[model samples]
Target: MAKLKLTAGRVRAFTCPADKPQAFLWDADVNGLAVRATLGAKAYIYQGRLNGKSLRVTIGDVNVWSLEEYREPKTGKVITPGARPEARRLQALIDQGRDPREVKAEVTAADIAKREKTKQANTPALEAWQAYIKARASKWSERHKADHETMSREGGQKIKRGRREGMPDKKEPGILRPLLELPLSSITRDAVAGWLEQQAYRPTRARLAVSLLGTFLNWCSDRPEYRDQVNPDACTRMKKDLPKPQAKDDCLQREQVKLWFHHVQRISNPIQATYLQCLLLTGARRNEMAALQWEDVDLTWNTLKIRDKVEGERIIPLTPYVKSLIDGLKPARVVLLHSDDALKRSPFVFASATSTSGHITEPRIAHNQALKNAGLPALSLHGLRRSFGTLAEWVECPAGVVAQIMGHKPTAIAEKHYRRRSIDLLRVWHVKIESWILEQAGIEQQKEETLKLKKSTAA
Candidate 1:
């Protein structure tokens, strides 16, 4: 091997022979340090003996690295600038009977681990929340999925309607947005408690947010990537600070039914008005009814296939008035010469043109307005469903019949194991209940015998 003191000019001028793949110019000062040259590139390299075997390692490209040492201005520390110091360090490791290759591998692995740790430490809770939603979304109902999204949504979007005169046009941030904006590792118990305190004004929503947060933390702990980043016990003991949830009992009385019907029927949007009526009559949940499609209704069979939360789906009788309301909403089929020119109909039953969701979404404003006009205290949409179950007692309907109609899970062995009534059998008690409620509400209902005769005639 040839040896010479390496300089910037000499290192840059070094080249390999045309027939050779690579050539090296050894440094006289540093035994292992050399400038290696190939057809396309030049780099500083080191060659040393480790455990009596020859070893080689590339230090850096000659274009990017300096051949002389200097002081770092920021830290005021001596900085080793070139491949010479690196070669000396590797020679010291060789003196210690350590392979320089193994040392480099260990340092590279440590750098990677440090980078990963820093990345995970700075990862936002919102990222984990999104991953959790995506992982679990397939199993969740549309309403349940919406609830999770609503909690963590970043607000400031322009409002379409219902902005008060003096209020800002942009909407407020979601209840969980502030907390979820923080890094996942920073979501400690104290942090969660502070968030809960900030959201104390809306206890109902705050409680729901905490419950969701707890579930999310549990999921993070179970995942290998997120396990070390999350504090699973962050939500534990949080309920002590939170207010206990009050059970709602807002069912309509028999006498109030007339007033409720009168005001609700006067609503300007017929789709909303009919939806409110169907909600009360069928005893189905608010979301279950809102998600109703045109295909779910069967006027010929007088059956409504309700998408059940307990079961996958449950078949219930589409009572006369409910059937009539749904019938009125159907688009008229026009005779068309060209199929493409014909109007495309919406799949949702209670269709809305303005909503992103094809069907009606927020009917509470209209419902609340009607409640105010009728001089009724306040009735939630669920109250209307509850009213159906309560009012079913008027006609002495059996518990099992009402439970099946309302899509309630059977509480007893007999109801769960032995009671699977046909849709026709359910219709018998269902129509009777619907008639009694309508009669109480000052609405005249056709007799069951007349309805049966009409069905037979139509058939």
Candidate 2:
């Protein structure tokens, strides 16, 4: 180390000595301030003791010590030394018993954190939504996955089938796509409120969309990157802004079954007609019936292995009328082939060439037409399932049997623990309920022949 009055000329001229490997010229004016000379470059450095520990910090490179004005390259005006002020600042921290290196490290860490936060704030809402789904989709059902995708589907083209409620000709934006367009950080309660208001025309769908969005936001809040940026309370705050879901009690009355069956039979699409009828007679959910495979129906055993929502699978009795309907189908198309002459079988019970799901996805068009012809008010597909539960009351069916048949959770302790009805026990009530429904619909069976066939099949 050599003590000197440091200047631009001397700072630039200093070089590391071969014997020492490096050299330092300590500033005479500033305590512990020095210019270090390596073999390749030079920089202003500070060395001191803070609370008995040695501290060293490089202030700046010698090349960037002055402001450059290339317009007057030869006679550029020289400003004050930049590194001197920085070195003095570090000295002040040392005077306050703080290590300058530690202080710089803290500042550098804070800057890095701020940049990261900014980057996360700019993440698109759709991008975050995708990440959220990818992380948690395994826990969701196939229908749950479809619900999210349907709500966020970008729409501008024409749909081939089923008229949309509001915009029949051209499809409009989906319920949640607008919210997903902006950055995740910008999805405030006010923004969501405005979105909900615009979607108020379809209150039922809007309510569902808001609920799903709230779930997505909750997922975002649990993530460390979005924990601070996303307000977990946004969903709660927007709840008051949403419309309360209306209670639905839509079902067919006893007399209406006559017209319901009449209209359903009139439908041009036989597959959809059978689908709607199956939904009513079995009290099965719409998707469950739509997703029915050929393997699920057992003609000989008179049973259906329905894919249930509550339980994984539920075996239900195939009643007389329902069994006849299944038997009447051209078996050649719905069965496995053993010989070259056998008809080609379709894997799906309700097969179609146009549907992406490889079956009848939406029967709404034909369903609505049926409603119009029957002079009945519009009802959802699920309403038919409800009608089954309602109409089953006519035959004095057991509550537990109907509940189990419908895949509903047991409501009472006895039903949950004490009683587990066998398929034969359920079949008794199920067949009687179907008979009562058919009789109410002005449908009469040839009892003698039917009984004979039943006996023959049993033997």
Candidate 3:
């Protein structure tokens, strides 16, 4: 290294020393400021020592970066006009016992830290939701998984033809879709409040969406990467503003069951008709009845093993009339009744030809038509299950026995832990309940005829 009055001309003329690969020409005007001349390019360099360690840093170049016209804030005038003005600032830092290289590194580190935070803040909520779902898909049922997908669905385009000719295309994105694209950090309580207000017209759906969103946020917070990016309790703050879910009581009264059954039997689709009647007789959830598999049903045992949400699976007694109804639906009927090509020898007792699941997805349209025909008030399919529970009280059926048959969890300690009733014991109450329900519906016990029919059908 040699001390030189480094000027534009001198800096340009500087070259690598013949004896060495490179050389440094220190500026005589500014200590520790030098021009580094390598084999090809020339650049400004700052040199200093911190804690007995030598520190050397490249300031910039002669042309691309040089003396920027920076006015002193207090003086409002220029003080330095030489090349590599930043070199002088580095020298001042070196004099203050701070390594310019380390300070540069610290500033660089801070910039990186700020960028990482910004990136996390900009992470899309839907992207996070997908990840959350992926992590949890194994634990969730198909219906549960479908609900999450439905919540984030971009609805299909409106059909221009047929019955839905003028209705707005349901293809619009779901309520959660807008929130899904937003950064997790942006889902504030105020944001949720605005969304809730928009959804006030459909209070029930709005409440469910809020609950799901809360679960999603909680999932986000539990993960290390997104913990700082989301507020898990964000949905909780909006709960007070949400409309309370109105309790549903649209079940068939004792008198209505007969008409309901009469209208249901008149439905052209035998499988749909049978499915509705099964819902009433069994007190099973709609999906549970729809998903009945051949393997789970045993005519000999008179037990229908139903996949239940609360109990995992429940064995309900296949009473005489129910046995008659199910036995009549032979393999030929299963094939002939299904209109959809997709349903070919499916094991589901109530298989559908057109459904994606090869089983009835929903029978609301058929059910509604039947209700209209019956001239009865509208009732949800779940109302049938509720009706079963309500009507069983007329026979003085024990609440626990009814709960067991319905796959409801035991509320009392004795029922949950101590009183594990056998299938035979369950059958006693279940058969009695079915007989009582049939009597109320004005149906005779056609046991002999059903048995004779089954034998003839088998032959």
TM-score of each model, paired residue for residue? 0.85, 0.72, 0.75
Per-residue lDDT tens digits for candidate 1, residues 1-459, read 889999878987899999999999999999989989999999988898876789898888887777766679999687656677778888999999998889989999999988988987887789889999999999898778988998898998998765545889998888889889899889999899888888777778888888889999999999988888899999997877877777789999998988888888889988899999999999999888988987998878889889998898999998888887888787621222223454557777887665666677889889989999989998889998999999999999999999999999899999989887988889999989988887777775665523211111212
Which 10 consecutive residues of model 3 have the lowest summed lDDT?
Answer: 450-459
The models' CA-based lDDT, in order, is: 0.85, 0.80, 0.79
Candidate 3 per-residue lDDT over residues 1-459, each given as its tens digit: 568777767877778877777788888877788877877777788787767888888877766544344567998886544455777788788779887777989999999988987987887888889898999999999888988998898768564322233557546678788788789998988788877888898788887889899998988888987888898878986766867878899888888877776678778887788788889878999999999987888999899999998779988888777888877676533452344444356677887766667777778778888899889998989998999899888888888888989999898999889887888887888778878777766666675834221122212
lDDT (tens digit, per residue) of candidate 2 on 30-54 = 7787888988888888788888878
Q: Which residue ranges in model 1 land beyond 4 Å of their true spot?
A: 7-22, 38-41, 49-55, 63-76, 92-102, 161-169, 332-342, 447-459
Model 3 stretches with alpha carbons more than 4 Å out: 13-26, 36-42, 67-83, 91-102, 115-173, 176-198, 213-243, 266-270, 324-347, 439-445, 448-459
Lowest-sum lDDT 10-residue window in model 2: 449-458
Task: Compare the candidates by TM-score and give the number of the best one.
Answer: 1
Error of 2 at 158 (Å): 4.7
Candidate 3's displacement at residue 264, Å, is: 2.8
Clash count in backbone of candidate 2 = 0
**Candidate 1 at 51: error in angstroms?**
7.1
Return whichever of 1 and 3 wins on TM-score.
1
